[model samples]
Target: MEIKEKITLDMLTKDSVSVLRQKFITLNGEDVQVGGNVRNDFTNCEDDRKILKEQLSEDYYNAVMAVWEV
Candidate 1:
């Protein structure tokens, strides 16, 4: 069976950034790729992939925590 789905993130709020980033990493690793046209603030496909890999790396916890604060 073939299945498709769409998900959106409301990361505009400061408090949600960490959770959003974590969720983004999880979603990016799945079959779905991040999609949207919010040019000014969205992470492109390449960067998204890189970050996803980084999120699973040995330094993931520290890396994610650091980036989450930015």
Candidate 2:
């Protein structure tokens, strides 16, 4: 599917994790390419990941992780 509409952080909602994941991918993709923990050296962006997981809801963070699989 093609996402033509502009995706903004306003679209993020705790109402649905799956939906949030899709939106997250559309916006942030995966910040997992940098700053990841040494234990999880396979991918970077661990600090960012942790921040999101802490500041934002777990659902959105999980969504970010789902895309990190790529």
lDDT of 2 by residue, 1-70 (tens): 2343221233333331222122211335632222222221112256655655665466645665666644
- Pairs that collide, model 1: none
Q: lDDT of each structure?
A: 0.38, 0.38
Task: Estimate the lDDT of model 2.
Answer: 0.38
Q: Give candidates' CA RMSD values in order.
A: 12.7, 14.2
Using TM-score as the measure, the top candidate is 2
Candidate 1 lDDT tens digits, 1-70: 2334332343433232222321122443565434433322334245653554554444543444454454
Judge candidate 1 against the unseen true structure and give its global Cα lDDT, from 0 to 1.
0.38
lDDT of 1 at 28: 37
Error of 2 at 13 (Å): 19
